[model samples]
Target: MSRGSLFQRAPIPEAKFQKTEDVTKERDADGKKRINQYVVGELLGQGTFGRVKLCHDTVTGNRYAMKVFRKQQLMRKKDFQNEGPGRGMSVTTALSKVYNEIEMMESYSCHPRCVNLVEVLEHQDSQKIYVVMTLGEVGSLLTYDECEGTYTAPVPGEWIPASSQSTQCSSRSSTSRGRSLAIPEPIAKCFIKDALEGIAHLHEHGIVHRDIKPDNFFITTQGRVLLGDFTVASKVDEHGRVRGTEGTYSFMPPECCTPTDESQEYSGHDGRAADMWALGVTVWVVLFGSLPFQKANLKELFESIAECQYRIPPDAPVSPEGLHFIQAVLVKDATNRLTAKDALAHPWVSTADFSQLPAYIEAALKVKEERAKKAAEDASVSGSSSFTGILRP
Candidate 1:
């Protein structure tokens, strides 16, 4: 695809939402109700800053996920910003993330697959900020995968983490429950194809989604995949540079995962290429239900990732096209890896058969069963580890 074609801007559509400038909380008077148009419902989820809730528009009855961030927390985060790059957060950084999310989402709102902001609300008295956006009824893709199938793989006592411990995936630490279960190759291909378009849209606008993972790709009740979460996203500068080692550990690119020492200067990474690397990891997890670098030892895992030492098991039912696509994207050298635009044009994405998706699902189920059996057998052995042999190129 041509750069000009990829960079084309799509217009944001008109929605019945109150503008940020017009939002204000009305103080409650004696036995009187507030004049707010949005009716806050159930608590949806919680984050470091605040919590999100289900909300409804009184006039149109449109549903939205309203994320409210506490001003005190945001300010506290701001006070800690001067410590170092990843040490602390400042109010300026907080506000920049909020505005950046709004701007980036609004820029691609016209695209049906991209998650868009519905409205933004601020309450000075309560010292909070609310972001209203499209609600993903199915929650995160991780939750969806976990709930979709039965856990036939018996849990080993040794694999169970201590109460204070958890498994790390890239930068994010998730409980064992958050571990992946592979989806069908055809379905993965479709989801990836859609996600690639959204990523391409972001790259075209000079924005990089620093954190790209299965959880971030939310699916609506209508079954459309929407790329959400922009708190860590950054816009590329004039030199196409973005600095920082922020993102989930499992989904981060090899370059971003390079450990820094006092003797070496921390060189920033290529934001666009990093996104592509995460995209490759996300696709691998979705299709195989496992990460390539699944070592219990973090040091070895980083070394494996740095060397592009991951295997797509031969017995797994991945098509040649699908395997080729993954190998192409998962290259160690960012300069040689496929970009979002290039990936979209790959035969694995463009020419895959949508009708054979059911067969693909069946194959995935078999692989899941085999994996579970192998896990059970390995657990019965003396001091056996779950690590497998890396695929040699």
Candidate 2:
């Protein structure tokens, strides 16, 4: 295949033509910087190993998300080379965690419904690794609507800090000044289908997205959903033995953390069941704007997830189909948990005909007159309010 125009450059000055070869897409080791010819925009985010920034394709005049990793961080330990058997990340294996994350992101092979890893950039004042990806400005589908005078969209996932959420929400709005809207059911289903397709692709390729969550769930400004941040996924063998307990504690399937006790891995298990659990959680959040389970701390949160101790909030009404699917996927035993495919076929998801619902529901929910009115009332009740204040943003 021919290389994209992005790589075109003037010929080398020295006798290098003899060694001509296609600039193969490559991964990187830390401290070796790969400078992308692309012009980087604002910083999107930072990972333990590096940062993600917006970069412009100078030649094409298009935008892409660029993830830059500090080589200094990666060099202290070998990240990608997870050769030995071990438990938690040691100083020797800390970099390995970052490396595993990069591999997981790249494993998607540029799937439309999964964040694509374009190239790893090396050149910079400081050593960095860049993963180029299509821009997503609308941001998360599970937006938090702070009824407080601020009236700001809540960050998609609770795991992301409030400060981080605020920054992302502000940046996305500055990129385009509109509140991120809840997707239409048709579009929502399409996005879900696209994600399912991506998962199928990964499963076919022997990969699983262990850390599937709303923050990791990104949608383009045009309303397309895709999975991101697969920093904890692992390859699954045919027998299904879970390779490791490598997911967010709350999102992980119980069997994943303790396969021997669960006895669900007749042969083995990967992250599939756990991924479905997270997916179900994602669906619940989309429909009801909250987690089915809540806890004061991480330990309590993990316990709730492991015990399947959750309930649909009485105040927040959800469609019967939606509730049914949530119930099934929230099963504690990984063996009984609904697979993504099965959940896709679930009556609520599959039989859900958003079109058939009252046409007025859209206008009623979208207009948010009640929410707006209530907000103004609350603002009056309070001494100071962001809505009443000078709209600092």
Candidate 3:
């Protein structure tokens, strides 16, 4: 079929589609790209950058996650400095920088726990880039905090973290058991470990997730984790970049909490340290079922994280070890914070007895399953039921 008219991801009849093993990546006249016509399927998901669809390799009959990036949507967001809500983004913002995210995601496709970056293709005449990737059902591990709606795969540089972060996905608000938002603990742990494995793989390969939060994680039906969205990813350079803050306000590390020396480029602190900070926040969310610095507004949140003065509430259930783990990574001083390697060795996580973790996970799964079954029954009995939270960062 010609590569001209497909738009959003819509469901296709199974009979009209074919799947294949050999991928179809090609270049057309003028060398632009003709990346269309692979038999799109059901809408897997949608995010700020683009949408993911379950597609079939018309020739091989194999399944793949087809990610489509809208050049214009990103372009509009590029000039974010002007938007009332988009303020706080660094000055000198460039629309083209997003390509870096695409490249980052594309390069690390083969790492096991990391989501595979398969092939990147462009549309016939538009600026859209069609990225073919492997689907991570229980995508990266955004704790229960980021798990409001669904796991939406990000574009290249917009790396989705293993911690389920739902910064903008309001639908993922948490449950504290109030018939409104009861967040159980075991499921939270499953999200944490799965995310750790994905980040562990990335750190092993010298790639720092830079941004790690609840929204970035994606979960599968079986609860596997996949670290995703590598858009802001940058190599750790001894010398920092001269400018730009490429991160969500809540997700930015302690250093980015406030610029120290703009002339020297604040990015030097990039790498495992930043990732750890994100993890610290994610862990807080998992256990508390909300942002550690949940404030009335951004200014308050910034001040709280900046002063490192947030409270853990005397009545909270956070473990001492868990508290230690959070402190280890959240240290404002880069030198004092826990590296990814050090984090893996920390007593809180290591000595927690993972042997019991699986049982906890199984129990949580059962809870979710029961919830789903009852919802189905409720739907059948009277078109009405209840709800829950999300995943992002």
TM-score of each: 0.70, 0.64, 0.65
In model 3, where do residues sit more than 4 Å from their true spots?
1-38, 57-62, 72-98, 123-127, 139-187, 204-206, 239-243, 259-267, 351-393
Report the lDDT tens digits of candidate 1 across residue range 1-393. Answer: 112222333334554444564564553444322226777765666565566677777787888777777666665564122222344444354655666667766555545556677877764465667788877654554432335432121111122234212222223333333333355444566668778888988877777888887777865555446788887787776544577656677677787656555465544567788888888888777766667776667787787887788877645445568778889989888878888889999999987545543443344345446665787588678566442110100
CA RMSD, predictions in order: 12.2, 13.6, 13.1
Which has the better TM-score: candidate 2, or candidate 3?
3
Q: lDDT tens string, model 3, 1-393?
A: 111121222222122122233344555454533345456655655656677776666566656677777777676764443212223454322335456665555444465455565556654565666766666543334333245522221111112221323321223323311221122333444456666767765655446677677666665544555667676675443332213345667766666665365344233444556677788887776565556666667777777777776666444444456666777777777657776556667666554333443443455456556655786688778977443222221
Model 1: lDDT to the true structure: 0.63
Question: lDDT of candidate 3 vs native?
Answer: 0.54
- For each candidate, the alpha-carbon lDDT, in order, equals 0.63, 0.53, 0.54
Off by over 4 Å in 2: 1-35, 75-94, 123-126, 143-190, 257-268, 351-393
In terms of lDDT, the poorest run of 10 residues in model 3 is 1-10
Clashing pairs counted in every model = 9, 18, 70
lDDT of 2 by residue, 73-130 (tens): 6678543322223333424454455567567665545567767665544444535445
Residue 48, model 3: lDDT of 63
Which residue runs does candidate 1 get wrong by more than 4 Å?
1-18, 21-35, 78-96, 106-109, 144-181, 259-267, 352-393
Best by lDDT: 1
